[model samples]
Target chain A: MKTALRPSVALLLIAGILGLVALAFAWAGGWLSPRRIGGAAIADALQDNLGKPEPGWRRAHAKGLCVSGYFDANGTGTALSRAALFPAGRIPVTGRFSLGGGDPLAGDGRNVFHSMALLFRLPDGEQWRMAMDHTPIFPVATPADFVSLQIAGIPDPATHKPDPAKLQAYLAGHPETKAFMDYMKSAPLPSSFANGTYYSINAFRFVDAGGASRAVRWQFEPEAPFAALDKKTLDAQPRDFLFVDALKRLSAGPMRWHMIVVLANPGDRTDNATIPWGAGHRRVDVGTLTLDRAATEAAGDCRDYNFDPLVLPRGVTASDDPLLPARSAAYSASFRRRAIEGPRPDALTQAGEGGAK
Target chain B: MNGPDTLFAFPARLLHWTMAVLILAMLFIGAGMVSTVSAAYPALLAWHRPLGIAILVLALVRLAVRLTHRPPPLPADLPPIQAAAARVSHYLLYALMIAMPLIGWAMQSAGGYPVILWKGVALFPILPHDIVAYGWLRRLHGLLGYAFFLLILGHVGAALVHGLIRRDGVFRSMAGRGG
Candidate 1:
């Protein structure tokens, strides 16, 4: 023996050393016994940057119009989850399609990342509410990273553009952010709301009547052909063209999208919204969502609803995904802030009918 | 004393060089991650997260090999203090190699992020969700990275001294040239 240490002893010692350091880090970094991690604070920080909240507008997705619809469930949902909305029946649905970000007056032509929030009233009175986005992936992996990302995007006061240095630094620090922004840059922006597909982006758990559970994520896939206007045409159109065009499209016929649910394999990640299941993942078609009528933001019932994604029916439960709760907390905070701010006049309605032509 | 041609086992030598390149690459990639906001930021992250986990797993494997098989002892004429310094520094490097990735993984976990190892595979979190924990772990990860980088410099410096100045086989033993 070259040394007094046995191989097993040496191995154990090395493991002990590594473990010791890891334990030290866990203790020092406050990773042990995590509490009050400030999800609420992060939400507050994001809202603070949007200046004071205006009445009748959300902290984000401020430019939105609500529409009424019915979800025609074929009852396939019971196979996966015993949610009451999937009783092979029609359920009342109210939805809002909105522009991304806090500016209520921002034109639809200027935004690419749009949002859709839906509230489905099941027969038994339970509700399923979801706030989803056009993009398939979220920009940041965690709520903390989300805060950093938002803070970094705040434009410098001098240049009216966000400082490249700050963003660069942030990107360097959080590498998981690349896929989201890249998807935004590469994916075609929908020319009309009827043409866009919305993604939940975060995964959840579905428990069937037998108490069996499966990890799943969902997307609203538009039945309409995916189409987009060129930048030249987009620029020439009126600021509120999306809402106007959506209304025109609805008048012509109902707007429809398939509500598709995707299931994850054993090793698939159910917790991270940033990491998405690719195209090869197993999926099932739950039902069709048909939006039959549209109402102005002023007249829509959706304006009063918060649309928290966690409001699920009996069989559907939230997974350990941190974004789920973070989103819930933030949306509530945004709703609270806006509630206190009071209602103001909406810009689209002010321009009168046909203002977007 | 064994001849200057004595060397580490082939697997050890292989891991040494592979990890040398990977560690250096990790440091640079990590530095670039925090400094740029261009379109390439996401691309960098695509490589960063999985690479970090790879380094972590490899480090543990390397430690196993190292603990099981001892490297040839320092030259007989070498002073005790220098020998002790060399041993201490090697352990420090190993400690860093193992710690950095774990802290990063823990940090992400605490921040409610996933440690995606590849396109489809992801490792579970080592810590529970907490933004406050995430913040502290993030800072520590960066600080340890600086320490790791500096230690790497010192490690390279010592290797150069042995290879170029002292004419000892210490560097060559791990370099794969010596027996």
Candidate 2:
């Protein structure tokens, strides 16, 4: 037992331990096995109440107007990361702008969450795809909570609308939802998609050239000042008034937004999408996004893309926000369901005619 | 090799004690996290993630120390097979210590989650965003946690045998005190 140890023993021991660790990790990390839990059930639960979308429309952003745009980065983006889209160059962009409700035919005059999804096709042919909502904060912290939120919002057969009591109970149970409710009440509503600021809501890490990383949240703020429609004007507008207004405005001239990236300071909450980092965080105006024209959904370049938040480029990476992975999984499940459902027969024809007009 | 001069260096001993407390706290927090449906779940998750990352960093430092500074040899009176088993178990402990946090990180990253350490400080992802990959990593992280607990039990048992029954200095080399 009185044996002298060699220096080689240390190397062999370290390497052997590391090798075993890698193998164990691979087996556990699913390198050796397939996943059992899927977002399929969560997707089904979310869509169950909404019913199937009209064939040609998206399952989620069913009522959307697509647009083509370009992102002109200020070159200052290099100070943050080496993302190809950041250099002083213009990147072609295709995206959709829509209201939040699942119903394609929901009236524009109704109080609803608005959103946009963008795909910036980089010079290298790869893309940075992102989905953003007008709200500064999401209603829930995790996908499970979101599914529960959706189930709570499902209309009771007897009420023809989600039971107010159920919603109250759900809110009582999930107090994190109060932040979103507060935002809806306090935040200004935009007159058009052209005017509203769209927030990514989730946190992402931006790596600089030195391999150091900073957590960031970005928002697309309109170049035009935010103008809220008064209640009287909102009530005066027609069902498709918002859509028509955006179409006319974009057709007349380019609608522009500043891509504002906010860096998280120490103690900022990055994991909880429902929580907002303080407004005082350091902000960087990375670029301008301009949309010149709006196209009908069927003839649009962005009709097929899912706008997955995880579809990030090399410079930007997702944060451990539970919502990020949940969103990706749910998006996949939604995408599959839509593919299975197929497009409507007359949808393309109608879209063409609409575009021509 | 048999004297107090060979006891663990102060930094090594400090890391060992700190990590032992953290790993145990993490296990309890993790268990509480999975079982809770209350609002406290997120709070637990917030602690669990940062603590896991801290453990990973410290474990790497500890491993480097182990590689550079050879520990005191086992007593000559100890059986050869028992000595070999001791080496093997130490290797297993180190492996679990190093691998557990890393896989947890990879699991979160594969799910397209930022491995937020504290405040806004986040670790770069080791894996790409893939739900299937995330699912696998998650399950693996859970399974390995159980392995970690069992190994700790064995480790503690062996330490007790060296300290209490064998009247050997093996335990004191790391613990710095003999009962």
In the range A1-357, model 1's lDDT, one tens digit per residue, is 223455456556555655664454344333463443343455555665564445546777888887889999988988999888777989999999898877887777764677888988765435688988988788876766777787787777667777889888888877678666677666778878898889987888898889899999899999999987675566677878888887778777899999999888878888778787777887789999999888767665666567777667678877877777667657645554454454555656776742333
i-RMSD of all predictions = 15.4, 12.8
DockQ of 2: 0.03
Candidate lDDT (C-alpha), each: 0.73, 0.73
Candidate 2 recovers a fraction of native contacts equal to 0.00
Which residue window of length 10 is worst by lDDT in model 2 chain A?
A344-353
Q: Any runs in candidate 2 off by more than 4 Å, and if so which?
A: A1-37, A51-56, A231-236, A345-357, B1-179
Q: Which ten residues in a row have the lowest lDDT in candidate 1 chain A?
A: A28-37
Model 2, residue B26: C-alpha shift (Å): 31
